[model samples]
Target: MVVQQYRDGGGARAVRALAVAGVIAVTAGCFGGEGESGASDGSGRSVAADRPLDLLGRAADVLVEAGGAETRTSMETAAGGTRVTIRGQGAYDFRRQMGRLKVVLPEDAAGADGHRPITELLAPGALYMKNRGAGVPDDKWVRIDTTALKDGNLLTGGVTDPMAAAELLRGAADVTYAGKSELAGVTVHHYRGVADLGRAARAASPQSRGALSAAAKGFSKDAVPFDAYLDEDGRLRKVRHRFTFSSEGPEVSVVSTLLLYGFGLPVTVTLPDEDAIYTGEIRQG
Candidate 1:
């Protein structure tokens, strides 16, 4: 929410870099190959090769075919000299382009309840938010029109479409295999690379003008490094990115991690009662 205020000039650039960096992390993958044109299995079908773009392309295809998945993200950063940790778990339906995510708010900013967790349910036309824990009146849900919000506002941009992860597959360079590793019990091939943010921004869908792309454009033109992992089938399993933003202000280091699993899993999404939804202006949490 604090990031929404920074829409132009210096601050906006910072937001863009941070947002785009996250996108690159979510979209990278693992494989073994040397060329950029295509990296395929011996059978000739793409199987998430080592080349950055090739691997991501294959992983995106696998995710698309899976229909739906659950994602967990862990973020660590320092803001105004204070360290923060935010954790989120949610499910997305690729077919409907909808998702629901619940995040455990950081303790540093926790209100009376010590940790007021927030949950969001996203649909094409509207957004819903529920703050749980303490001091909530009647526990009513706040509703906001998806069209009214500024592009890349964290609340709206963060979870609009689960399938939007595919957009991260763009603008990869300096790709190479990092090695082998195990994540959550599955064997995976690891790969690392840098993102060409400008290229990625240009390739982004019109609706993708959100925080990540904008911030990415604000950073140095040099490609930012990122890492990703994939299973034997080319399904992206994990990813991580770390960088420091130091252009216009104090240097802030960001470490972001994304874990994708439970592919094709059915998830039920429950919309709040209309009577309990507030259509009026809602303040940022």
Candidate 2:
């Protein structure tokens, strides 16, 4: 779930809209199954038996070289024994740090017709949303300063930024080669570890540093557990990160998953004009 806090007049107001709902509850699950154990590292040695911190750390660099790719994202959160998953699909330009996604919220969040797919533009430090319900006009866009979000828009956007997700791996530590696995008909190397968001911020590119740095401090903990899959070419084919937020009542758990494919795809993202942004008060749930 997503929680958006923006300043109106001289005070800040929190909007718990259905499209960008605030965190309620979540439960983290372990990563296991799928793929064999003790796979060979191409030299008669078991790759899974070795810790490949360097390989995991370079995952972002590899994506940058790939130019761009089509992306699919899934975020699952549970509240009061009910779980909802938000799904998105789009393309991302890794080099430019820009992308476009159409995110769909579950029907239960809104009435059947009200849960229209929201168009989101992901840029350096801001997020633009269209069809963002919460007393928002259909023709106007809601612009959010990602830096101001407590989670740095990581969890607030419902879908994690693909580029940011890859960059987070730069701080991978205590990583272990899980084994070889087949994802979407392609073989990939699976690795599991915990990433230091603070370290990743320092190593991230200029476009992502500030947002990641803010995320490092906003989350319940800086160390985020993840499962990353990279192909032989070193490109990040898939990644899953578990985040916990404890700023309010109980700790909230969120599982963010990103999948990348169709490399070298052309992607175009344009930001909205100042006049197109909504500056009025956003109604709360």
Candidate 3:
């Protein structure tokens, strides 16, 4: 993939303002779904030694080992801010392959989807990319001011794994099984993820330096996402989610479509109050 560098989205935005931005909210502990908060109601929860917990643990292991993109919907929700959503298609091969991602916003959406296609392939530092099919992308791919794309939180590669997702939420959220519910025709088990703003930030601290452990504990958790995962047949299927941001408006409660298991490729997105989010063929090099 050849990335033409045009500095408009600033650090990342300017590098490739080719798509609507993503703001990530990563919180603490464990893997999969959100952690329940508040004192226990005493009705009993998934005991650590129970079959459900064991099954969940096995499922979590499957997710980590499988390590392929299972489709993803990244959303941003800020207090009194506009809401923006970006769904990535194609499996995410963090260390090997370049992932193809698409960007979109709800029609007349609270926040505008900067009509751009992120033809950018993920690398280490440079956020350079190309919109291979920019001129004729799908309808949800609306264009917005380049400034709205400012923020690296939208990059899900660093800590989007299930372990990291669960760790961020479990650190402060109480863990429990919400029984079972039917969603999109799948028998789903829900985990309540109470936003532990602080814990999430701590878990997001980049790999600690050999001697910089001192600074690690003080790292900010303000950037971690508060989201939940919906599982089907013991596999992490969709994200029951919303984010914690300042300028991205409204809490969007939605179910995401995941494909290819752990690779980060999301073929479709089901928004709670809007149309489905999807992308056409992404000729990603």
Best by lDDT: 2
Q: What is the lDDT of residue 133 in candidate 1?
A: 27
Q: Give the alpha carbon lDDT tens digit for every residue of 89-123 in model 1.
A: 89876556567888665554342345556677866
**For model 2, what is the C-alpha lDDT against the true structure?**
0.73
Clashes of each: 12, 1, 45
Q: Which ten residues in a row have the lowest lDDT in candidate 1?
A: 23-32
How well does candidate 1 score on lDDT at residue 163? 40
- List ranges where model 3 is wrong by over 4 Å: 1-20, 23-61, 74-84, 94-98, 105-114, 123-128, 132-172, 183-185, 195-227, 230-233, 245-285
Can you write out model 2's per-residue Cα lDDT over 1-285, one digit (the tens) per residue?
A: 124322121111121231344321111121111223345769986664464677776777778888889999998764334456788999999888899999888776654556788888999998888877655667877777677566677777789999889889988888887878799998888889999999999998888888898888766589889999887677889999987544333344578999999999988888888777766432222
The top-ranked prediction according to TM-score is: 2
- Could you estimate the TM-score for every candidate? 0.68, 0.83, 0.45
Off by over 4 Å in 1: 1-50, 124-127, 132-138, 143-166, 201-224, 243-248, 271-275, 280-285
RMSD (CA, angstroms), candidate 1: 9.2
